[model samples]
Target: MFSNWNKWSIIVFIIALLIISPILTIFYSAFLGDTSLWPHLFSTVLPRYTLNTLILMIGVGSLSLIFGISTAWVVTRYDFPGKNIFEWALLLPAAVPAYVIAYTYTDLFEYAGPVQNSLRTIFNWEGAQDYWFPNIRSMGGAILVMSSVLYPYIYLMGRSSFLRMPISFYQTGSIYGKNIFLTVALPLSRPAIIAGLALVLMETISDFGTVDYFAIETLTLGVFNVWLGMNSLSGASQISSVLFIIVVILLTLETIGRKNQRYFEKSSGQNISSIIEAEGIRRLIYSFLCFIPILLGFIIPTSVLLNFVLKGFAVINFQEIFSAMFTSLYIAIISSILVISVSILMITVSYFRSNKFQKFLIFISSCGYAFPGTILAVGVIVFVGLLDNFFKFNFNYYTGGIIILLFSYTIRFLAVGNGAIKSGVTKINPNLINVSKIMGFSFIKILRKTIIPLIYTNIFVGVTLVFVDILKELPMTLLLRPFNFETLATYVYQYASDELLEECSLAALMIVIAGIGPVILLNSAIKKTGKIRKSEPLIY
Candidate 1:
């Protein structure tokens, strides 16, 4: 059937197959072992795990919308005091991981912590009988923690949508004595909100650190427990299949958003006019609105970690910490380079050379990112183990699993690289690729000589972002790393899980610091969004 396909198309298809092979292995491995565990799982842990996962997704999704949509609307709609500062500062929380924030909140709100202690001092009450305080380890707490860090996805997307909407829409709402937000802005911004919410929900379901630390028993955590606690690989894969279904639905939501995005494309280059001039009480309210999410997501957690570092700075374990830091940086850098290389090849071919089937395959391959890290790790391990068995080499998990890490990381982050490459490719002259083809140059030669140089900036952006993501990654690094190997993320996880968070505070802080670069880039991009006008082509 494919005999007429060009070499480039075949090559792209094979790469997509390699990228999707692990996901295939996951479904295959689910049926390989005992079939009896399914009843037990469904009766006991599976129902609870599934319910908790849904609840977490709903809770986090709702809260992220409130935080993200509220802040986006406030910053874009009202001219409040400190409005300029809030635009960029609101994104700071994206730098902190959910698990890190969970650790910080646990200390701040626990029974023996300063908050309860202060309350006790004021009310002259003592011990556990005094009053009821919310547990930071409960379902509600998990929602709060996850939402704080994840809301930036919605904020960024929604704000861009709001800015792009025609001012006439809001003006019409106002002329009719309607709330512009409810009547116009919110309605027009639904696609962007759903897109962002899909991302937030995906992050919520994929989370292992916060759910695991809080003992919430989400499906992601169930995969972990079933695999390690019960030593049943098949059982883990079955749970991962459920998580896989959730991911597919989220992808559908994203697709719907993307399809409708063109409908709201900015029609005019005019700036969005602020409807409300925040002053006095309104200014205070709007300012406080922006402050809360920032306070919860970035400030409190960062401050807690900073306090720990300051107190422990003298006796910090510089040797071990430095080693783990180097390891994390090394793996992240190498994995980013590989991901970008494949991304450039696949995206260039898909856009410039490949047919529809090849483009579809390439697109499908990038969906690896939608899988939870644990689910993807299980898939990768099963696939790699099969390869090891067939090859009969000394490449077991104990000795040579770095290859597994690299492979899995490539799959997990390839979408980030592809997005960047696609953005860059869109701006280049398509005639350049055609001219090379007319001269009888192969696709590879044209790609090397023409496409790569034009996209260097985008390549740098993709690699930098992916490197930071891998640096902060926990589930895959926790489960699939070579024996005795540790990244800074795993290092922080180990110490924090043992209630020695102070020991790992420095490493955790470093991860947060590295993430700030992406925030800076995003802020710069947002600044330029509606400012410059594209010159119309005279030929068109």
Candidate 2:
């Protein structure tokens, strides 16, 4: 029946199936599970898991705001030494994965590591008991590591909002004796800040890596333990369902909060807000504050990696490393295109379809990003297993399949693509579509000739960002790869699993290198888009 519909309808259905499959699988398993186990879970480990997840979310959320918002404010509002470098450098941490940072931190701070050894030599300390250092494998360490890298999400969004604000707002705040930072900037940018924080929180909740490395007893870890340790995929699915519920609730709250508050520049005269120059001691302190996040996020870990590479201590497997890099790039590119295209289609349909049911369906489709990658991979496996079995019973297919994993990745990464494209589309005046309609253009024609051309750059940036994200993805790829596929992320995880990080440095660094292309492209696109928007003169 849908065959008569436009190509977009087919596209939407296909993408919807991809997004819904894993969720349906989880729901199926939840129904099948002997949830007599729930009582035991609640009595035993569930409370601790919930508590740890909450603490991690709160800690990382607050710290990332401090790191992300402060630097964004300073760079956008004030002119100081190194301000130019800090504007871009603050984003470098996004190129590094939280898990990779966790591994690097562990190596640098462990008992046999150089920091403790150097201190031992200097202080003539005897052993572990002679002097004390906080273990890097703790909750606090996970917070520090995650916040270091994840703050870039906030910084990106927060900086964009801060830069787009009209100078008149700040001027009015100054006249009213308001603290601009606390009263004007913060309140004005709350939507963007909350959106960024929502992304960070979803990432933190769905994170299996940092928590696993730190041995934090969070819900994600519990999901894994229940699935693999208890040999029960159903129990695992039930837990993942819980995680999904938490994410849905948070996203819902965000949507509700922003429902009544519209953030846009009403008087658009291409006004550029002039930066305030800091003088003397204040300037020095501001520079120091701006330096801290990037220092911890990029410099330290990168310096350690460089040391390993330069000391000739790490062997470079050029052939194997090159092969993994190629594989990673190919997969990232393919998945990125698939994800961004699907996201744009979904967002477009949601905006123009005018049917509430269709809009809600599109919204639900993007929600798959909330699942932890490994758990979602399992859902894909279970769902595809059922599909393959049915096909074999009727026609002839099997559990091991190819498109299954790609479908999973699209489901898992669509939210990032959706968020990016949605942000861009939101900036455009909705009346443009109405004007096109009044000019006798069909919806698809208007979308093709108008909306697509207008948001083409956002689509590109979204694809590139998703490409980089896929390049760094580990758990889903690990669980879902065909018999012998190896991406850089999986390659590094294997050796790093054995605590042989020196051996995996090439692959680990390759993940960063794979990301650099997309990161550069994204920054350039964002900068160019801002410039174009700024150059357009406003009408009275």
lDDT of each: 0.88, 0.79
Q: To one decimal, what is the Cα RMSD in angstroms of model 2 from the true structure? A: 4.2
lDDT per residue (tens digit) for residues 105-197 in model 1:
998899888899999999999787878889998999999999999999999999888876666677778899998888888988898899999
Off by over 4 Å in 2: 1-11, 257-272, 312-314, 341-356, 393-401, 418-459, 525-540
Please estimate how well model 1 matches the true structure, expressed as its whole-model Cα lDDT.
0.88
Instruction: Give per-model TM-scores.
Output: 0.95, 0.87
Residue range with the least summed lDDT across 10 consecutive positions in model 2: 393-402
Compared with the true structure, what per-residue lDDT tens digits does model 2 show for residues 212-271? 878899988888898779977877777777887888777875676456335545555655
